[model samples]
Target chain A: MADLLRLDRDPAAALRETAQRAAVRDWTCATLGLGESATVLVTELSCAEPGCPPREVVIAVFAPHAPRRQCRIHCALAELDESRVRAAWLAPTPCGGSHD
Target chain B: MTDTNDKVPVTVLTGFLGAGKTTLLNRILTENHGQRIAVIENEFGEIGVDQELVINAEEEIFEMNNGCICCTVRGDLIRILGSLMKRRDRFDRIVVETTGMANPGPVAQTFFVDDDMRERFALDGIVTLVDARHFGQQVDANEEAREQVAFADVIVLNKTDLVTATELEAVERRVRAMNALARIVRSDPAARAAVPVDSVLGIGGFDLSRALEYKPTFLEPEYPFEWAGRFDLAAGRHELVLGEGPDPDMGLALFPAPPVEAEDPARVAAERAFKWFAEDVEANAPGTLLRPAESLAILDLQGTGSKRFPVQVDAPGRYWLVTQHLPEEFALALHDPQGRPVRPGLERAFAAGHTHDDEVGSISLETEEPLDPRRFSDWLSRELQAQGASIYRMKGFLNFKGVDQRVVIQGVHMLTDNTTLGPWGEKPRRTQLVFIGRNLDTQALIDGFDACLAD
Candidate 1:
């Protein structure tokens, strides 16, 4: 996802060890609303950089409220993305869509 | 202007996001019978799918600079269109696609104001599209929706296939309230082009014909207004109205009327008193209350014809808000340096204690248990007379103590008449009056509501 942001200079990078099936479950359980006790699987991850095992993992994000509920997280994220884009494209308008 | 042979009429295609504006534009571009068109897209905010849309000539996108279009439209629109006209052969008719939230004034003005530009580009009329699913939500609460309709030469109620007959009628009812002129067409873009380019080319002024005329009467004196198209108001409760109608005086009169500068102690003091207004509304309602769009129009006491002053309405849970002025009176006030309530009359009206030694506009607020419609209207009439406010329009739903049903009262000062909504039921939750006047106490009217409630 950071690749999508395409920010400057430092260029985001990260690392997390345990690179195994068990490690993947723990990380995802915490992230995917599975709670610490739930068993995990090799659902998602990658090792694009090579040499290093695929440390990055994937888990379902839950709603801030109604915890553990699979609320439309897409709405929240979509909202931010929607507004961010509208704001970025704005310049001088010939005026708003209003009239006398 | 250039002869019809060389210079083509520039049409502005505008409306809310997902209102099929681009879809319609794409239709015109890809399926046109025979006409070269160049398209320009100006988004309200940053993100834009202009690249995704099509046209014959190369496209250009202008981001609203840091300032507002009202303040900077002159410079920005000119640069884009001025350049477009330079590559005359590349395109024939120029179509402008505005961001769903962007106003269409500056865009329209590009033709009206500049001589050289005017000579080359003709004002082909404003074509605003409405989403059938969310037209009601957009028009009832969204200032942009009303603006778009008010100034439209042609309106495309796109997505007619998605809405119900009853809901579509409601959209037309509301649209009639805001605008008396406009040509409306129910369109399924994929099936039929909303309006053939020939019918649209060189069209000017509002076209008063469509899905609106046959519907029931309105709450205003205009009776059967020029209803053009029908749409779905409840289609998408989640969607908000995007584009406003076209503004002629460059955007001086849209809602959130242009800001009144602090030129002297008087204006400065007045502005200071109202400063808390923007922040307070935003704080109180959170997402439902504050609107950055209205921020520009509200701050002024003297009105600019550019924008509508911001007004708030509590409908169900969502605020059915607008800045179109209702009737009222006015009295000038002496203010304090801090812009607090210093004048006794100003203090009493707002019921606000703080005073400033500055000039503030004042109006009388009189409420009685019986709530005489005639008498109350008289007080209101007197208020408008005293303040000398150009009351463009006024409407409200009042539930009186004795009345069994709710009362719908509306007036367009230009028409000099108002109609009372009958067959009222349920006492009004609260008696509210909104004055969308310039340099006047919009807050004062809201405050009067709390004090003037049924006793």
Candidate 2:
């Protein structure tokens, strides 16, 4: 929680996080073999579920006519690495059907 | 890394078919608002006619994966907004024009659900246009129409000249019933969808605090509680008895009712109670005593078929009670110390429900081959003339034979517009087109594009 609040108090921290997220998104796309048309969303959400980390990064992949795929990393966006992303993608969890 | 105050303001424009959304959009672009505005439109048909109607701005159209009706976020909006924030200096604000049949839920939800969007862009408001004469039928016939009215921060009743004053009053009544919170402004009939720029732009309709400041009774339908009751109480301990219900615990808030002279007293108290219920919860086990304070308290109703909690009232005055669910659902009742029922003097139910349009959908067409300009134009004209009624919105980039620049095209029904958007340069030239509407023939559209390919 303090780390997330630092993003609001420090401009440098926010910029660093934004850059890191963009890099992670690019790496995820490359590792997952997703095209430009596919929409890749990387979000850092606070986990309320017991036994889960305080904060985690959720990466969701959406493409036309394909089932939505996502993976959760038990770490903050800054702590995420390419190896972790690849590992998550390899054992990706199927997301719920439709946002409706 | 801009501060929250410096984030760009975005306004979402939505309405039913033939509601003068494009006319209002043109007025916004032509007006001297002193702000450079970038417009993103999701037209129903494949030709970009709305883009041509817009002046002094380049059209950027992105398609979302709407094949699954349950997809929550508008993928196209997320992609376009992400790119727009990168070149934030180019535009002062952004206005998104959704297709007429759009639900506007996914469009508005995109701002809050996406982390990057939430940080960089603030949803200024959702402005909906209503065709004064046809709104009544539209609202009754289409769920999308009703949802647009329900979710608007500002409702612009356009085409007033076409309807009589009596008929207009009836329509306004219907709009008000659908959304009591929205500020309804009648458009200038002589000017055609003309509205005061300030009424729509720069309004913090989405800002909850600002909304509450503007209207003390500002309550969104998505709140947890649905009903609020005002009761006249004496200075003593009252008992709140609850029967078996769904949840293990129930959230409750008790606050001083607003003065009788206050405007919309019921809503004012409801809004205040809503704030209290959102605060940190203080849980009380069954048979425990709870003091009525300006905060939230939870009653643990588990393990007992019926639980009783004492509510202490400090002073004899009017107090409001807000429960997480309707009291009837839990068979909840309040009693005076003597065991007599303490009935509420007033009760108000907040509107709560969500609906989506399942009939409307989008089709995407893509080809690597460049098109013959003359042949493509003739085919498009013929298609719009024949099937424009069914085709709601169409937009995409076209790669023309012997033309270096990329041609942008968009259309709504019979209206179509196109412009050459500089040379493709080193990028690959591929024609991508998308049509959003009802009852579209996928094979026919694909074959039509194939026929327009250069030999």
Candidate 3:
């Protein structure tokens, strides 16, 4: 549950310290541009039951760039099921076109 | 090592002109893709390589040669192989970039004929780069174009970005008719698929024995021989047929017109007819009268012998330039405009270098010194450079002072990149350069050639 509060470890330690110093003012919310500076807060996530995933969730006090970032993440990862990749792996090419 | 087991691999990079063959070559060098590769460039441009330094010293630019006229022994190609055998550790692959007009048969023959070369290097198949845009036109003009396709085991339908789907399909069909066995990959040099040099070379692009299993038919295969004169014209000889395709019903005996020997009196008659054709084409076409090529025919480079050469015609795509040369003795035969029996000792030259085959009316000054095993090659290369624009292809057997065997110098048109083919086990001989061109001047060329003589 405590691990959910941070992002992945930076390979180059240089950017880590930059992120660390800015954390005093609850920087993750500001970096995400999710809300007004005063409204955002860093809070740990609690499971509805005893222990589930998302042990921490930075609730979006605001979400200005939500659509754009969500779409980009979806494209790169394509975990979203709508992609043709989700279709039958061996689907034959539709040869129904009027080739004439 | 006694070396019976040692084998050399020859890799061929072939493509229609402007199909990014050079672009692919540059990437191969800059990336340091693998072992050392000797690049043979078939050029449409003057600069061989713009880079300050290229990896392979054996890399050579092919201008034009009279190989089409000379014996198909390909002595120069063998010599290049001889040189490669010496620097066994220097290069891993021998990449031969054939002229746009090349047939590839003679180049391949080099691998089979020489026993020593056969032992050292094996044929590594051909990688053909096809200009997806003009693929149809190139394949249609002459069987040589089709031969390039058939010989290739891998065909890169390059410049895919420039063509529509229909155009690509037509090109694909023509290529398929010529070669069904080849693996076709469509790409632009910018595409990542084309980047990995191994993708093109590592794939077996050609199989000679397989190519021989072919049947050529002129079934109106959507032949594009009449494509606009304007296209990407690389330096090499083109066989322009005034005669129709052999009638299929006539069977095997229906041979095309036997090439008129330059020494034959009939060759003079053909040259006059060709000259009249050029003059008519210019009068009708007007301003484009060979705008790209500046004709140079002077008893002296000075104004006296150097006439305003209006008879010469440089076609669009800057491809073929037709010119005429006449021997001083046959001057009278041409003075009266005769399709008559009086022979005119003239010569015709094309992109394949000089051919003084017809000495009566049209003379093609063939640069064959390099073809001879007796001449000096480096000197011939220098001579070829001076008469640069007029050259089609030149192959010469060379000898560097320190080396005991022969080295081959192969040149194509304005692309002066040449490779050291290797050393001859036999005594060093004169470098032979077979020059094929339209209206090429042999004597004047010889004078320029004299200058390239080794000091």
> Whose TM-score is greatest here?
2
User: Once model 1 is optimally superposed onto the true structure by TM-score, how far is the C-alpha of residue B36 displaced, in angstroms?
Assistant: 0.6
lDDT for each residue of candidate 2 in B1-455, tens digit (9 for 90 to 100): 12347888999999999998988887887788898888887763332333432212122222222232212456667666655665677788888888898877667656655555666787788899999989978976997897787667789999999987656765775675555456788999787789998888988775433443554433334455767888999889899999987678888888787566477676787667767766776679977877778888888888857889988888889988888767876788999978899999998766432232334444567788988777787777667656655565565678878888776664444434444557899878988776655556767887898998999
Question: What TM-score against the true fold does each predicted structure earn?
Answer: 0.36, 0.46, 0.34
lDDT of 1 by residue, B146-263 (tens): 5666556667777877766545654554444344345566775356346565545556332111212322221112211111111111211231211222211111111221234333
**RMSD after Cα superposition, model 3:** 26.7
Interface CA RMSD, all predictions: 29.2, 19.1, 36.4
User: Runs in model 1 with CA error above 4 Å?
Assistant: A1-100, B1-6, B43-74, B189-195, B205-455
**Candidate of highest DockQ:** 2
Q: Write the per-residue lDDT of candidate 3 for residues A27-56, one digit (tens) a residue.
A: 334344343312221122222223333232
